[model samples]
Target: MDPSTLLITFLFFLAALLYASVGHGGASAYLAVMALLGVTPAEMRPTALILNILVAGVGTFKYIRAGRFSWSVFWPFALTSVPMAYLGGRIHLPVRYFELLLGVALLFAALRLLIKPGGEREGLHPFALGWALGIGAVLGFVSGLIGIGGGIFLSPILIFLGWAETRQVSGIAAAFIVVNSASGLFGLLQSHPPLPAAIPFWMVAVLAGGWIGAELGSRYLTAPWIRRALGVVLVVAALRVLVV
Candidate 1:
């Protein structure tokens, strides 16, 4: 492999470890790194989505086996999100516009984390289903458009909506990401675009890194702290995208 491709593969591995350690799927970071590497946005989105599926699927299965997932809470959001994510993948938009929007979305998520009000811990509020579906649709669309897995936005929203406790959110997020990614990938497949043959090495690296990192995060990290740290990282990533 060329030095440039090897470097990108190494970066993907590093990103996977960081995300696994933090309970993130690493879409924003992947997008940022791809942009910095001068990867076309068209290639970046689908490639990242594929990586998100591989990583998040492993994490989700682990969480499920450990009884960390709550199906009661996951399905409603998936109902709306899966379809919308597919729709988003089908539509074509300007790369610059999409990246700008992604940056704005990340910034908004970070800001929400900073100022969110603390309140009684309700397990999936009465109106939360509606909110979940609505939010899921919007997030799913954006995720598909950008080739993201939707975990960055979905995890925080789950925390904000009081659907699940902070400790349980990561596993839930993993499952959510897996589902949306599958939908998005299906949408992309239907479009008949040529797949990048060189992506397998990078995918393997990300998968390994994400699995190991998520395992550690789930075992040792505190939920609230993980959420906060993820927000900080998102802000930095957003800045990187916006500036470049």
Candidate 2:
């Protein structure tokens, strides 16, 4: 690989590490990096979603093995998200619209990363089925449309609503990302978008990073500063997408 490609791969690894450490799929960061690197719009969504599946899949397994998962807290949201995400994936937007929406999504993801959620209190609230399903539908559709896994949006909302604790949220988010990314990818397959030849190399890089990060996070490590720094990068990339 050339220097630029090598650097992008390294960034993908770093994005996976940082995101999976907190139970995320790193799609938003991947999208941001691709945008900043001038990757074609057609390639960005599939690439990010593919990487998300591997990274988030690792995180899901690690978090579940660590006993951080909650079925009650996870299912209601996922029940609705999967199908909607698939539907959204099948609907391709024009290039200008895609860039605009992706820029907005990146900004939202940046905000979530920049402002870390507060420590969980002792009392955790019960998951509200109606609210979760509705929110899941919205997030799922957006995830499919924008080529993300939707975990970035889900984590904060769950935390803010007190539906799940930090560790539980991580587990739930990881699983959610896996399913959504997979569903979105399957839906995207209808069009059979061309994937980059280097995808295998990138997937391996992210898988390694995701494994290491998820191991540390599920055990007892949270890298807030790293997340915040990455959030900064996302913001710059989002602006680039919007303006340039």
Candidate 3:
């Protein structure tokens, strides 16, 4: 294989490891890698979603087994995101400005993560159905528009808002990523985005990375470092859009 493909695969593996540890599927990081390597837009969204499914699904299983997942916390935010993500996936936005906006948003999120305290804390925000619906719809739109699974955004939100602890956030984020990705992929079906021949290879690569990472994060990795790594990922993604 060529350098670019090989590099993408390697990074995907690493991304899965880091992301799954925190209950993500690494879609943003994958999108960044694809953009830096010049992957076409048509391919980027669907491919990211597919990969998101693999990593997030693994994370979901692992986190659930670890007793970190809470259905009560998960259902509220997820109630509306699926349809919104599908709708967002169907509409095309102008690439340059859209990506620029997304990059800025990611940069902001990274900053927030960098400053937060390390250990998981008791939830501070009151969980309201309205808040859940609002956040879900907004993130769902972003997921469809950008091909992210929305876990990156959600994990930080849950933690910063004190809605969930670190490992619990991972569990929730993993489940969110899985559903939104599936729904977004369904929305992108009109284009029949060409699955790269190497997708299966990437899947297996992510599987291994996701399993190992989720295991470590759920069982071993400290909360602070996971947030730190997530900050690095957001920075890379932002740079891919802003400078790459």
Candidate 4:
């Protein structure tokens, strides 16, 4: 219909490619896109969460099949995150607050990930259920409140705590994002809020991008490329949230 809609869809495609490559679902980036177009704030969270599910679902399957997944590593964080994310999604914020928080979150993630890559070999750190649960709950709630999948927050913590190597972190983040998005979407649906009608169009774009990007990142692309692409996505997300 509208030319702008096509542009936004294209942008979503590219964002999904970059974000899914690094194990993200690109909700923050989607929110940024919606913001720039002056899409209704009330609609943004539900819409973004829906898109997050599709892309993260693809990413999760791809990474897990590539042998990057660890159920033991995933369950602890997911245990608390799912419910907490649901709780957060149920509470609605004012439009301005949502925009501000999304921008700040994107900026923080961009800066955190811009640091040099860590150890090449996977770290053999012991799984700490307590730490994972605590971190998961916090990020999940925040993700729900702000309309994200929380992978950006979780992956960095995993790397910092030496729980997983870079690629492993990507896989974990992909799975984590999928569940959180599902939970958040469930919560949002309860409110009878409207989701964008363009969802079907957007979903196809993201799924295709997610498949291609996740495949390349998991099998062909090196760690450095994934990291760089993630950085670019985060920076663009930050700018979109702030300026739009």
Per-residue lDDT of 198-235 in model 1, one digit per residue for the tens? 68888889989888877776777766567677678668
lDDT of 4 by residue, 30-120 (tens): 9888888878988888889988999989988999899877788888999999999999999876656666776787677777667655644
Candidate 2: list runs displaced more than 4 Å.
94-119, 222-244
| Predictions in order: lDDT | 0.76, 0.83, 0.85, 0.84
Clashing pairs in 4: none
Q: Write the candidate numbers in order of decreasing lDDT.
A: 3, 4, 2, 1
- Residue 206 in model 4: lDDT: 93
Question: On a 0 to 100 scale, what is the lDDT of residue 130 in model 2?
Answer: 96
Error of 3 at 132 (Å): 0.9
Tell me each candidate's TM-score: 0.88, 0.85, 0.93, 0.91
Window of ten residues with lowest summed lDDT in model 4: 113-122
Better TM-score candidate (1, 4): 4
Clashing residue pairs in candidate 2 are: none
Tell me the tens digit of each residue's lDDT in model 3 across 1-244.
Answer: 7888899899999989988878889887888788788888778889999999999999999999999888988998888999999998888877788778878988998998887655556576777778888999999988887888998788778877888777788899999999999988899887677877778888889999999999997888777877887787778777877775
Q: What is residue 72's positional error in candidate 3, in angstroms?
A: 0.9
